[model samples]
Target: MINISLKLAILAAGESVSLFYKEQLEYFFGDAVAITAYSIENGSVFSPKNEDVYLVTTVSFECNEDILKYIPKDKHIIIGDVTFKNSTINRLKEFPINTKALLVNSSPKMASETITLLYKKGVNNIQFFPYYPNSMETYSDIDIAITPGETRYIPNQITNILDIQNRVLDRNTLIEIATTIGCDYLLDTKRFTTYFDEISNGGIGIETLIEKNSILRQQISTITKSEGIGVIEFDVNEKIQSCNNLALNLLDEDRSNLLFKVVQNIVLKEGVQSSKKTKNIFQTIYKNKKEEQINLLFIPIIKNDNVAYTYCLIRKNKDMKRENEIEKEYLKRGHYSRYTFSDIITEDTRLIKTKEMAKKMAKMNAAILITGESGTGKELFAHSIHNASERRELPFVALNCAALNESILESELFGYEEGAFTGAKKGGKIGLFEIAHNGTIFLDEIEGMSQTLQLKLLRVLQEKEIIRVGGDKLISIDVRVIAATNENILSLVKEKKFRIDLYYRLNALPINILPLRERIGDLEILINYFKKNLDLNFIFTEKAKKLMFQYNWPGNIRELKNCMEYFCCLNERIIETTMLPEYIKENIDLKEDKNQSTDFLLILEILNILKKSEKNEKGIGRSYILKCLKETNFEISEAIIRRLLQDMNKKGYIISTVGRGGSKITQLGKEMANNK
Candidate 1:
């Protein structure tokens, strides 16, 4: 006999047939396998200890990508018994043409894939409704209902209901078993005969198999010996057949008293009954003799369409306290931003319109992509939109994609199962997506996200779900995604750095914020707003104001706020032009020639020409500037004059609109011209 001891994790095994499949696999492998089953609905996964461990997924077609995220393709064993049968297609065909049907499955993704499959298989006449667990009441329009198991709800309009049973053990079981066990020739005559005999001729029951196999017993004992965990096994009649030492100690009952006792007489009796009825995993809290709450998980094991045995996994509630603390820490870090639309202090008409459009967009649930230069308040807009939306009461989680490396970013966004990697948390962590459920997730610097993560994010946006790292379960989330980027996302897509599909999905409601220099009209208002918030009594001199307006604010509002804070820290009642930051002064002076007097003359002459053009109701172009320079008896080249005009525009002496509109003199420009 092969000495291979396999630890198999079965994912999405909540269905009764899936449970039956699990029992069959266990029975066929006998004592050589230790199985841990998980339901995708529960959003929990069992972490395998080593690379030698195997993973099997009975999840629906849509969840294949999700399962693949956690398990390597080589390590994943595809059990053929988990799939639905062609009878489902035949049942759909029985319906009249143009019939409206509701396809109910474990998840929305599953239902969607099933509908697509039906259509591909020539059942296009029926309109299918993807299952929405929370919106079952709205399913009254459903004409027919098709489900993988018994229908949870039947609307009056649903005249026909079809329960499509998934095959428990397909003919490919031998091939699956051989592949799963790493055996090369289990299909050979001798090996196939032995395997067939073990499965067909009164296979050993799970309890008997464990009792007879000392190695299996030792493995179970070793696992159950972990501190703070309790395990118990019961027969099909709900009689406790075996209880680990941890369970005995935790329940405050010895084996003599607990063994052979009906499980309904013990703790979690109601949960056991519920799990048996539904054939689904259930959890409940049980109070021990010490009045301490214990978390109990009831999992039923099915065999030949009946419950063969059930396992009760128990742990002290206190064991979860640490995990809760970790979750709370992440929650604290994901607190909602207090900003609102009213907080965006701006007088610029274009910016006001943009804000209004954004407010309207917020009322809808589509994804929004905000594009702007850095520090242009893209995140501010994201916060304001979230606060104004219907989901304002929920969290506004913001993460900078560029701030972390790919590995850390993936873990923070999607989270991970326990032992997903080195130094992982004990019970795994809840990602920002889970934390921001029913709210908004602002992904700033989204262009910086890796291509791999972009594809994952695209799936989440499309499917409205996420699967944790090292976990096969799909967690549904209802979050409004607001992705922001300083770079041009379309350009990145063209460059093949970002996924084009994701770009289009996120760009459904695009909002572009103008840079500070383009919105100079808002500068004075922003300055006063920052000053009032800083509680500064200082007043800016006319020269100081002119100097600020003249310098191009490359850092936008964020830099302006910093400048205001620095001025307040100086404690000066009156702020002068010379008191500005050295860099600002240097930048201003750099625009002029080394000869300050000559530079001043050049600026004055250009302002004069622009002011004349304003009087003439005609903007001054480069050709006009050359003519004015020649008339002023200045021997400057056309290039020199053009450069001077550009410099004067940046200095706020002129406003140059795009196209053939040319440059026009501002009121500040007039003041400088008259003063000179």
Candidate 2:
């Protein structure tokens, strides 16, 4: 006699049943509670004896049609038709409007309803009977029979009936019940149909994302073997129906074993469970069959057509670097300096053409200067030039001229003897230029070098040698010099801040790297290149692109990269204009440019007013501003207008408010003008 508080769901569907079952488990094992029930289905609760256990009834209706509609569709229903048993049919009648042939696939609902009604009829025959739990062998030989007199006995003819009831009881335990029982079976119409209108709808709990590492591992293995890179499709069950060889190789798993295994097993390891903090990339895909269809770029596989498999193609989009694959490359040990010319990202036509020129000059020991805005990848170009040259076999060293003071710069560039300065090595310290002998020395921000140090560098370049700081020993060295700067060295020379001789020596061949905004023609190519190579979906709306184009990017290429990363962190597909940072959105115009010949200043004023207003207010405000300008006949200079406003405010003829201060038709000013 287990005192189990079993939760029986009578009229629930499959999804509801699953939830109910989960709740029942928590209610039981979570609190050390127990449950025992005659029927787990909704609307079926029976009690023959009260032996340390309580009996509870719950009504559940499983119907392809509405329960209320089904109840009124039939008339003159049969009461206790035991032979006409079917799970889909509602046996008990709740409504008297109509009666149809009732579906009674099981005797549990019918018997419970009949026995309940018969109790009022003074028929307690079945209700009072004490049916004890017994083995299958014992139940197989037993049967229940009602004698003509006041008596009941187990008979041989009812052995199958007893066995069936016992089996149902065994399966009806609270923790062991199946979803199909509550979802499909025991749809008694009597209690359920009556209560259907009264029950309130409360939604189920949020579903959790389970780990799927094993599945991903298998997919990776398949992709690796496929030897191609392209998009692939998988069904809801993660079955690979059709995929190009490229997509298959991207997954790197055996296609045969990968499909059979669940995605959870491949991506998330079997034993090591994932925590809630772990992001489920495939959550939307697994949760819903429709609308949740995923669009992900398979690793190393470019997803050209999200719906179909395609041929393998190498990603030529340099700016569109994928974080995941890049992370993999970065984490590998001891490969920092191995990055070559192929790794530099640039879409600038001038830069591309400069790189070709650099390649030809790499054979010579000629000094070169790469000039660009900060983050225009000057050092990157320097590295590529060094790596492509004959000095590639030698160690390539680099130093930032702006990062250190003159003293430290000199010590760092040239070696020091024992006790040369404070904390000098006992033996000696090797300078960067000495160590870079027979190699390349990349001088970044050469424009920031001090005039005094520039003289020493010029001496080194001319003499092709160096002298130690403490020791006067002259050490002749062979090293190629590559200088880079974000500043205008010619202007620095004019200001006497930089040595003219040093500038000429280093600026032998000046190459300028263009800013990102100047290469707007390559924006789409760069964006798509990143989309194809990266596992993310970062599509830009037309409005978002307009916003991007409107700004004068002070940070240049670096700012654009940061903005892209920021939006990517938000996991957005179509980056809308609204999602941009405040500075970008506030300063830039996201609308299309009209070709009408308006003065730049007037246009700027119009744009500012439009931006300050909301979407609904923009049009009205623009009209007002245009009308005001037309009334004035555009005669007033903007400066004169400002002076007039100041005078008006000083005379108390107009009042201005903070946050949004603008000139208006002041009542006193208008009265004074009318009087005149």
Candidate 3:
């Protein structure tokens, strides 16, 4: 109520000019500062009633004793690096290439400044000559004239005019102002950190660095915004500065009632004494109006090398415990790349070369397109490339493009703000892109992304920024995208199914993984690796290997893994061609007693399925085998099973019970069945 905000007064040559600069300051600083303007040419008077103030005036306004006596004199800064509207650039672009134009402003200094800014903004196509009121020089050859909302200064002879509207202070000018007013701490806030990047045509001189508490404060903001925690900041004198939504709820007080209120008088418990301004954490327990216990973690922090602020993170007791457990569980399953180039177990010359090339591409920052059949380990290569890159230490987020529908996938990839959609999370969610900042995002099945999503993704690739699903804020991210697709993207593009621009954007660096069949050299090595990894004791006989090599593994490495798993399940030591899966044996000639092997497998399958009968010492009858074989799809009859049993009996693998008495597996047959 004391009006303690900072103040800045402006003195321009005319009333309109003075109000113009004052408007810029008001629009930027908002209520953070109080602004006033007086025109020197109009002989207007500026009387200061408040002792706390700052003055911004040209030498033309002679300083009266009353003004200096009222406010203290500080250092002076000449504002220069001002920025204009981006629409200004767009309007200038409409002019013919290399067209000559005149830039008219209120004064010669302002005119030259505007022209210089235009050139810096890459509007070199248009030649601009500086013009102002009462200038001795004139440009008759220039038919086009541009003004920064100072059209009155333009000569009437110029019919074609482009008004850039008005110029405003750029980031650098605001930084200087904030620093001058001892409000530089605001620059580290989320508002100023993303201030220039958010606004339209917000000029250069972005904040180069942050103070000591910037990162810690950012961490605080992130933690505070999370589901469980609620953060509140207060000044050294116990005056509340800020409180989050959860905090307001937990305190059972509205924000308007809590902010700027003293803790001891209104809300704080007797045990919660005024904390001294130092680096310390104060833990306390309090019962809210709902009769539920809440935990408070008060941390005193020094900002700008001064003990002016402290933070209190509050959470309900039960929620805090649950949140801790969830956090621990999250730590167990983290976002990390599990594979590197060394993990790619490949002996094929082509695959080896592909890995080497991919490793080379990893050092640079660009979008990568991996084309291969499904299960070819495109994600493996993606992980390896990220680990080999400079951003290896950061997160590695993998999302399947085909798994989610359009809206869900968009929300997951780019996140959404609170109240963005129905059932949106309270604080919204941090997207995979934000989580993968300064790292890599492996988008599996990129071709499966809808056309609309592809266009949005193209914008991200071009601008290195993303607007959340239902948010206007532009979040700048430094993520390296590694997109993979099993489909023929070029074909899809030609068919108008996929966007060509997005394809080209993603295909900046391309890697095509050969399917397992084309690189059969790696088959044996991969088999061994999968066997060892799966802890399988089976040995692939040369016949089985031949059959496997003959097969075209359309499913690629993942299919090969499945094949190994199948052998593991069979629990067979001698994996002959007949033991191979039916799919693998397709179109292959097993010529060597293929019938005998088949019969052998049938008997094994019968014995394994039925095992030893309970009431009888012998096994189930041959008719049962015939029944199972027929049920499972085979044209064989009971006579075939009888002959197979007789041959097996000759080998002493089973007790010969050809009559009504069922035949049982002998010890030798059991040994083979058990894979001994």
Candidate 4:
């Protein structure tokens, strides 16, 4: 234990470097030490403070002796043990095999030492050229520069400078300080262990991954007797180090062929290529020789965010497969298309023509984007398109992007490694893309996907491969994507909420289905079909037919189906104008007092604004309207504005056009605003 509170000083080349180390030193020693910092860049190196101990930045640090000249003689000094932050080492590993980056530092020796530190941390992937101040080396061809918080020394040509945010002191320096300050007993505390763990593995905080290997073996032995899980341990080279009998059983491999062998799976390709690329725990699906589907969980024994050893746990898949109603013996997994082009019953030429276009598009392998309002049967069209395609015999997986949140949606769509993040699945799960390989994946409400996910999907479209959430292995897929969105995706792209390149990739074969209101010619046939499908012996009267024709189906086909269900529940054999649902009836009823309603009032205000802006080429947009409404303490959403504009256009009060034309107030709209 320290008899007195010790004072220490840190000297570095720059202010940022000095302050960073100063804070680190203070945090390391806590209240037991008083620390001061000085830097040559800030001209504070000669402040002339007598200190009990001096910590030079690094062993390779120049002027280490000169910096001490300002201090009192015979002071206990330690050259700091510096290392790259664990985060920097992980980032360095992400660079391609031949990626070149300039490693900038304060001095030539410091640069070389830092590069060595990176190599020691297992960041040997990138080719890092050392760059220090006034070094006559031109790295003009290199686009990226890496530095340990030394950004000012980076050359002007390098635009993408990744600052690893200052070199941090290694556990050795902390121990050296502890011993020097008579506080060596602090080494036994959890706080010190936590710091040590962070310096080792970026705060994941396990002293040795060898403990995990032992724990995994114990788990394999105990777990097989109970849970019947199969586990295999593999090294960075993808060579099998250990495998239990349960694993051999799952793999259907004989003992003579399994033990101490390089692993080669007939299915799932071991779910991972090289364990060296794997940094986090992930899972994939594979099948054994018996055709029994199994889940392979690649649990990485990580050190400093790099996989040292992978513990693969195999569990049986719960989904069963068998031949179904198809003539060919198809693997029935409930991921098959339920509709063909014949199922899309429509009398309208535009719809029939659109269906024909989609059917022709199905023959091709390019991506498809289906756009329509909610209840416009976009998903129905997607299913029909897939069934019409050659992949109809294969899986047709569908995912509603809007239904799940970002995390759940990501895992559901792309699949994830077990323990990818907090609350991740235990055994891990297969993604839809993996399940839909050699078939079609229908992403419903594609607009609802986050921009981050959009980029991933774009990559999948381009590369025809997917990386599971928290996984590194590229799983190749041959899938035809059919993405549907109820929202105007182009508007979202213009708003920067969606990626434009993703839009083009998906919109390769576009299908814009008309809403029920626009395609009313097919409404009667659809109505009767729905009634017959529900086994309802119902008929609508002439007055009811008029109301149905006049009233806009806001909920579209889904709302109409529910409306039919409502009538069926009412025990009505005949549905009249008075028997309609409130939502449908409200349109007719609300019209009488429409002038008094707040929505109508807002509509009137918008009409006046549009009337004024009618002379403009672009007219007026939702933003200007929102801005105007906000000025008057009115709260409104863009969706509500869109609905209002759509209703106004339908009523002939406004003429709305796509793109830059925006919406223009009609003569009727001017008269309506005058009424207000």
Candidate 5:
């Protein structure tokens, strides 16, 4: 024999109905489970000792944050025996349309919500009355009184009484709850068996349950019939049981002929089957009026230790073309830019000037080129420009030019015909340029595009039209192009790597974004912006802020946002210098050698300063170097300059001395400056 002992607690907010529930629970699970009732208002005083305790809440709305503190989350279940009944509404409709009826509930909010639902369902004749402690005495004129099961008070004047609690629960309900919570004694009760049979065989509440199931089935049928994609269902015997209208149309067969047909008889050509047992996708030729190649996805739904049914999604082999086109419509709506010129959080003068120029360019319908290093908010600028432009109401479509290869990129930009390629969509696919008509198409990382694609893109910019990859017809498009590149496209054009014509076409309105290191003064504002958006209550210590300002953010704003997210994940209210990312903390030690480091900007600045000093005949001393740096708004310590001068002299870039003469540019330094 197995030993079983479980403790169960019933919590109610000072309601007398909890005693009835406790009595019922003891009658059912008294043999194996010990039952206890507690008023949640007084609080739970006893803690279980080496025993599993399950708590049941009598009221749904009573499970507030305060109550949750005293209870284990997984140990509690809320069971409010409040359910909608069609029979109750049907009985109400038998009275006159303008007949006055009273609806009452223990909670005012619940009563209001139920009244609203009833009104929406065309039950406008009812007057709602929430049963307060003694408010039932005022409503003596009501013809019918409706109350939830838990409400103990009802006026005697109302002749027609419909109690929902009496209809919702019975002996079967308690037995099912007991079985669900692992109290098996309730399952074997003779009264439970009798009640279960009575309920299942068209008893008092069976009609309501059947009506709910029928309505749910109707909804499922409507969904299956209206969906654009083909959906077919098969029974466990692998025979077609039901199919949607789209599936019937795709198969070119009537519902009567398709029903009950085995799946093997429908396919003419076989394809590879997936290794997984539950779901698989493979190519096959279906025998409709003729042989048609399509891709079929099989999904088996398991129930009751068997495959209850299998759902099959069918698509033509050419559907990949339409897949992205359909997804683009949804993406255009959900992923539209929520950014504008005002959204760029920066106060740096250079970035402000760039934004001002971009705002002016947003007024014109010309191809704009945004140039910056990676993560310098190039895409952000593109979004802002589109959101502020004349085409603000239309779609702002964006594509990463480097993400796709040549063949896919061409089709995605220009679109393709139905029979243009082996896997082209059934009805030809509309490309991004066509979808983005009268709007803007942002092509990020334009320098990564091949020279061949560059020539085609140039044609589109010049003619405002495109021809599909394998088609001869020209499709006119009116989209504004905004191209962004991290590389210097002018250098690429000069080297014959990028088309010069395309560069000129896209450079109608050029904008250059400054990197994060150049605008270090804006660090605090950006940090606060990120923290506010993430809704995290965190403050960076002064040392942490100072370290962040000194570090060179190679990844720019994106990296800083990621660092803030990391701090938020740590659940720390105060972010200190030691808690920062390893790279940011290490940057403090690297600051002394920054001038002598292999940073391209620092190296180029040293060479430019030396070359300029040579022209002035004022040798590049530490003071003169500092003066030149101050002129360009760069502040570096004398120690860093001394280290840079020593390293450059050793590397044959300059000749320096500790005495009055300072440093002079060497032949190699002059050569390096000229090359740069």
Candidate 6:
């Protein structure tokens, strides 16, 4: 048997158990074949010891895929780590060759959810191990309840168990388990009893215990207050137990005034109306008693002698906010009111030609269709076309079809009257078309709009007017329409998913933006443009530039922008070819290509011929070579090719070299080749 040891990790309520697990796993694994067990519920780590006993303070959900995400996925193991994401349950049995058995366990709720999600994801071959603390028959679905030093009594639930044997654990069951149990096991019976005993008595004693809880509350309060985040705590009775100042600040009142008042009036008075909501909220704090810093935790505290008093904690991590802020800053830079034509950038002569045509169509008040791949800047071009036309002075409205559903899109595009729906604005609202009445409206991702909405839009395009969602008023519109889609409209039309008449009306002055690969000539220009605007200084090496030109650019301009931004953040200086991702670097051949390179080299070889033929006028051809040199950025070998052709001309051979500054073909040399 493969040697395996297990370790148990425990922590006080509100402490992160993962830190201890992480430290221990790193020490034990050390880039070895060792399996590290992590409790995702409590964020704690577990490692195998020589003794084979695993101790846990609390029983939390564990899964194999989670272990793989942290370590290597292609390994064999008996016990699995737990994960909240439902996608991982199916692949557990197929881990490795040495994997003899797979153990799957879950809390009551997680069991159902995991099985359902897994079944939906097409996962089979899971052996169920339902954890019951008071069970001893070792059923196929029953595993020994996680307790300290109980490995000998525990059955190999994956292989030999009765109730949970040879059955596939699905995603729904895993989700149910992960949510209910969290990651850590609670072992302190005394603490559980103490909490339950105090809450069961149900005495409405107003004790000044805020000062006692203040120290514990301050830990989360100080961080949230300095960062402008919300933090609050509740007890088993769903009463406001404690909260940081920031939590009350977000509520626009203090803890003693607004926090307590809201809890007493709404949540507490309601008496846990939603069990699903309350269970999910309460389980995190109940399961992971060790976890202190929760990201948006909604904890529920249950108080009674039978069950321990529970605490609900909800938190949003500060790191995610910081990352979002950075992305928002970038998005803000390229956006203006309705994002008009000024945002599109292009130096391609063909695209410029297309732009001229698009602008003409825009000026004529015709419906225009823009089509291209996802990141090819279709919306930017649409905005630019609108701004360049006479509608520049008027409002330019842009709508995202994919962002809202049918009902919402209808309300957004066509004005809705007050009381149109349950939460409609009181006075009523102006539609996007109305906002751009005398100007232009751009619809982006039009393929995502429902067929019902498309039919309505076709009417708007053909009629030049619209009716409010609830009102019968036919509002006349002088709006120009520009629609863009990454999807193929013809395919959608063929599929009967989109209206053919709408496509025909919108197809007037259709513009197809060439993807980045087709216009490789513009790569250098775009790279330089991005580099100039970025906060850091980054240069591309010649090899790196060559790799850039070779990339297929699946994500188009957006990918390039993201890649350049990442490079800027990662390095201050040059981006070398080796530094690029593997796929980009693979096709790049820095070495010479015989046919193409030699032919180009022949042009530069001309310089030697000129030197031999026109010894006295050798420097005469230098200026001609200089022009070619400048074009090739002074790759001297190419200049020599032109010189060779000039020399051949003087020698009565078929060659071309002229110009007082350099080399060209003589009439006699041309005649010689013609005669031959």
Write out the backbone clash pairs for model 1.
none
On the 0 to 100 scale, the lDDT of residue 125 in model 5 is 51
Q: Which residue pairs show collisions in model 4?
A: 282-417, 283-417
TM-score of 2: 0.38
| Most accurate candidate by TM-score | 3
Can you give the TM-score per candidate against the true fold?
0.43, 0.38, 0.44, 0.41, 0.40, 0.38
lDDT of 1 at 596: 51
Candidate 3 local lDDT, 1-676, one digit each (tens):
4353566666554577668877766665667777777665565534543423444332222222232333344434232235665666776777778788888987755564456556545565676667887988778788888887889888989998877776655554566576666666566666665655433342211111212233234334445546766878777777788889998888777788778888753336322343453354466777888888887766665556665566777878765453454344334548779999998998876777678668867865657889999898999999999999867877888999999999999998998889999999997766777777667889999988999999888777767799887789887767789999989986797698997556656775668898888888888889889888999776554457777888888889999999899988987887877678887766564456767567656867765644545246556787776777788787797788788788778877777664688777776676557762
Superposed on all Cα atoms, model 2 deviates from the true structure by an RMSD in Å of: 35.0
Candidate 3 local lDDT, residue 88: 61
Q: Write the per-residue lDDT of candidate 1 for residues 414-510, one digit (tens) a residue.
A: 9999999999999998888888877889999998899999989978876779999999988777778999998977568658898655665687566
**In the order shown, what is each candidate's alpha-carbon RMSD?**
23.7, 35.0, 23.0, 26.7, 21.2, 29.0
lDDT digits (tens) for residues 9-56 of candidate 6: 222111233344444333423332232334555444323323222222
C-alpha lDDT of residue 404 in model 1 = 98
| Residue-wise C-alpha lDDT for candidate 4, range 1-676, written one tens digit per residue | 5444678888787777788888877776677888888887787777787889888764323443355557676787676667665666777788888778898998866676666566546565676777999989897799999988789899998899898877788765676677677676577677776665566642211112223322223223333343456767777666777777877888788777755667666442445453345454466677677988877766666544566667777777653431122212225458888988887778976777578567767765667889889898888898998888767778898888988899889888878888898988786667878788778899999988988899888778766788888999887767889999888876796588987557656765668888888888878888888888988876664457878888788788888888888888987655656678777778876243443356667887899888777778776877888888788787889898888889888878888888756788988778677655
lDDT of 5 by residue, 468-553 (tens): 86789887667889999999886796588986556656865668899999999888899889889999876554456767788899
Tens-digit lDDT string for candidate 2 (415-498)? 778889888888766677766766788899887788788988987876778888898888777778999988887678758898
Backbone N/Cα/C clashes per model: 0, 56, 0, 2, 2, 90
How well does candidate 2 score on lDDT at residue 283? 19
Q: How far is candidate 6 from the true structure (C-alpha RMSD, Å)?
A: 29.0
Candidate 1 wrong stretches, greater than 4 Å: 1-331, 590-676
Q: Model 5, residue 658: what's the lDDT? A: 69
- lDDT preference between candidates 3 and 4, better one: 4
Best candidate according to lDDT: 4
Q: Which structure is stronger by TM-score: 2 or 3?
A: 3
lDDT ranking of the models: 4, 3, 1, 5, 6, 2
